[model samples]
Target: MKITSIIIALSFISACRGLNMTRLRPYDLTAELMFIFEDIDQNGIMTVFEFETVFDRYDSNVDGRVTRSVYTTYICKSDPVQYELSHYLFDEYDVDGDHFLDYHDYDNFYNKMDTSADGLVVKTEFVNYWVLLFQKYENSDIHPMSTLCR
Candidate 1:
């Protein structure tokens, strides 16, 4: 099942690029994966409850923390494409320069999503992050993920 999800994600990336090259409005593959991997309830939105559940799953050994290894393993199991893309995103989560993601790191991330500061991340806010990331991919070439996006 994990491999199948990766294959589908890669397919989406390739298909989107093809459409983009043709000057068409392409699909957003990252947003698709966000929904697939993070939307625990599959209700088309990631509530706080679902996000906490995912956080606990990645916090192996119930230590209330997530190391790079644990996060990489979780991404590999959830979506291989994301596993490959992890290098581009790891530093974003490893707050405090400790090379691990703890509750504080997660809180920082959630704060970024909680644009209204209402303590909740609706579907639009969550999906828009990926959308903006992909748009940034179009303007920059320094990042490895940008290369793939093109």
Candidate 2:
């Protein structure tokens, strides 16, 4: 679709209902956003190992999978405010058809979200990765997704 058409569609969609809008990020070379990763280790890369560490921490049954129940458990225990963040991230990032995120899914999404087309993403991309799930990110929430909860 053309840019104008996309804008028109967005306008129409916005007119119909609410969009849980997030603030637009600043430029690529910002001082703070460049440093905002969760950084499970000091590795400086959002590697599979790092993601798995976080993922495992949240998986309640040692199942190595973040099912809905696992996700809820993590949200309630870790960051309740953004408990939905895992759902948002998993819904979009689990692209491998495995029903859960292994290294491949996480790696692909991590790379794509590296929007500068650069080899590495800065702090902001990690934060905004799930927040922009429907638009430039792709309408994938576990391969079948809803644009919103309500």
Candidate 3:
């Protein structure tokens, strides 16, 4: 009985390892955002300057705007898993449907994140907003790890 149990457990473990299971948890989003934000001052708050720094990286042309192509390239280079989320965020941020993200769009996003109407965005506020935004994806049968978006 002992030997049989051991063999069964080993088989189960091996089978589990073969599966591509990637769940998008809140912490996963939080960690990704924190890493991207790069709180240089070690403060828990995200300022517009920090956001601008991130924007500048994607805006390779220094045109003060980020195009979808540039954003996709940047995100894919950093983390392929972020591809879907990046596109969703880009579309939502592009308030004017201009196919580009500019200062105006970013400002609108910042305001959305700063739920308390404060000039700054705390980690909780940022994470909460993203988690809520991702609710639709979470509810769908489509896995976040999959390339397809529902």
What is the Cα-based lDDT of residue 10 in candidate 2? 93
Give the per-residue lDDT digits (tens) of candidate 2, residues 1-150.
699999999988864443222222232322233334446555555554565566567666675556655555565575543333446556666786566755566567667767776666555665555444434432222213322332
The parts of candidate 2 lying over 4 Å away from their true place are 1-37, 42-45, 84-86, 115-120, 127-131, 134-150
State every prediction's TM-score relative to the real structure.
0.64, 0.49, 0.71
For 2-99, candidate 1 gives per-residue lDDT tens digits of 99999999988776543132221242555666667787777766666777787888887998888877777776676555444454456676768798
lDDT of 3: 0.70
Ranking by lDDT: 3, 1, 2
TM-score of 1: 0.64
Q: Which of the two candidates, 2 or 3, achieves a greater TM-score against the reference?
A: 3
Q: Which scores greater on lDDT, model 2 or model 3?
A: 3
Q: lDDT (0-100) at residue 85 of candidate 2?
A: 41
Candidate with top TM-score is 3
* lDDT score of residue 104 within candidate 2: 62
Please state every model's RMSD to the true fold in angstroms.
Answer: 10.0, 8.3, 6.9
Clashing residue pairs in candidate 2, if any? 91-141, 91-142
| lDDT tens per residue, model 3, 63-150 | 9988877787787677666555666667778999998999888888889989999799887787777777766454333223324322
Each candidate's lDDT (Cα)?
Answer: 0.65, 0.52, 0.70
Task: State how far residue 143 of model 3 sits from its true place (Å).
Answer: 13
